[model samples]
Target: MLNLVLFGPPGAGKGTQSQKLIDKYQLVHISTGDLFRAHIKNQTDLGKQVSQLIADGELVPDSITIAMLEEEVDRNKTAKGFIFDGFPRTVPQAEELDRFLESKGAKVNGVIALDVNQEELTRRIAERHKLNGRPDDDAEKLKKRIGEYFDKTIHVLPYYEAQGKLAKVNGIGEIEIIFNSLCEVIDSF
Candidate 1:
């Protein structure tokens, strides 16, 4: 299976590009953000917990996140592959994901890291907030989420790099241009 991880900070266009990748590659798109949002919207027990943590801009505990992800993966047993987005935000999470995938006799084929500067990320997020108005898109929450990414999540890149499964794609361009760059990387895989 051609499992892939699309890594980037919030508002780095991971969501946008993931859709295109899903269309072209026919991969199951597992986005933790979307998962959390669904739970929150449904007001499940897990959703209630996630809602508060997200309102506070804290990362969900690995156990909860992992369990949720595994369930999604299990539900899509016949998928050709998976495009993981907004997940494995820490080295431990990445390690756990490796273990989980290994048990299923699959492996992450590669990681694509979108390289977008902080300023651009902030600007794009601001625009997105205007359009979507997601609670987490508020300026204060966005700041914390972005900080959390750079402070801790970005370290996961090195973990993948060490495995020679990391590719960097410039994320400062038109949507199609950036999408083409990402496709080139995934195609190489």
Candidate 2:
């Protein structure tokens, strides 16, 4: 199994590249943000809790996020692999993911971190907010999310780096160019 963690801050183009990776590699794309949005849209019990935390610009508790991720993975037992996007944001989360994957005799093959500067991310997200109008895309929430990534989530990079499983891709170019760069990393694996 060729599992991957697509790591990046909000507005770093993780979602766009994830789609291309899925197409080329036939990977199940498990984006926590997408899962949260789906639940919120469905108005499930978990959605109610996630919605409020998201509205307040807070990270969802690790336990809830991990459980949701495990359920998604379980549902796709025969998947060729999985692209984990917007997940394992903290060191603890990464450790938990490693343990979970180990139980199934699989492991994360690689972790790709999209390297985009804050200014660029802000600009891109501003444009995206105008188009998508996702509540979390509002300026205030975006700031918080970005701060959260830099302050806490970025630590996850070194965890993988220590294992020699982290690769960085520049995220400030044309979509195809960036996707191609990501493919090179995955191909190397």
Candidate 3:
């Protein structure tokens, strides 16, 4: 099994590269953001809780997020592996994931951190806003989100790096080029 985690700031192309990786590796793509949005759209009990948190611009509690992931993993264990996107945003969550996978005798094979310049990230996010019409895509929210990512999630990199599972890839090129770079890294692993 080739469980993997793709980590990056918003607009750093994590989603795009995850799609490529999923297609190439036949791995299940578990995107927490997508999961949350789906739950919210369906108005599940958990979704109601998360929706309120999101409305208040607060992070969904890790327990809630992990519960959602646990359900997905339980259902998808038959898959070859998984590509975790936009998840494990904290050290505690990472640790929980480690334990969960350990119980299944599976561990993350790699963590790919997509590195990109902040200016370029902002520009790309602005373009995405125009294209996707997401209400939260404004400059102020984007900057705040980026700042929060660095503040809360940046430390998780070293945790994976110490385990010899973190690979940093430049995220500023053509889509194919960036995807190729990620593929090369994964292939090495």
TM-score of each: 0.99, 0.99, 0.96
Tens digits of per-residue lDDT, candidate 1, 20-111, equal: 99999999999999999999999998899899999888999999999999999999999999999998999999999999999999999999
Clashing residue pair totals per candidate (backbone < 3 A): 0, 0, 0
Q: For model 1, which pairs clash?
A: none
- Over 1-189, each residue of candidate 2 has an lDDT whose tens digit, in order, gives 999999999999999999999999999999999999899999998899899998878999999999999999999999999999988999999999999999999999999999999999999999999999989999999999999999999999999999999999999999999999999999998
Instruction: Give lDDT: candidate 2, residue 117.
Output: 99
How do the residues 1-189 of candidate 3 rate in per-residue lDDT, one tens digit apiece? Answer: 999999999889988888888899999999988888789889999888888666444568999999999899999968999999988889999999999999999999999999998999999999999999765567777777788788998889999999999999999999999999999999988
Pick by lDDT: 1 or 3, better one = 1
Worst lDDT 10-window in candidate 1: 49-58
Supply candidate 3's per-residue lDDT for 9. Answer: 91
Candidate 3's C-alpha lDDT?
A: 0.89
Deviation of model 2 at 102, angstroms = 0.7
The weakest ten consecutive residues by lDDT in model 2 span 48-57
Better of 2 and 3 by lDDT: 2
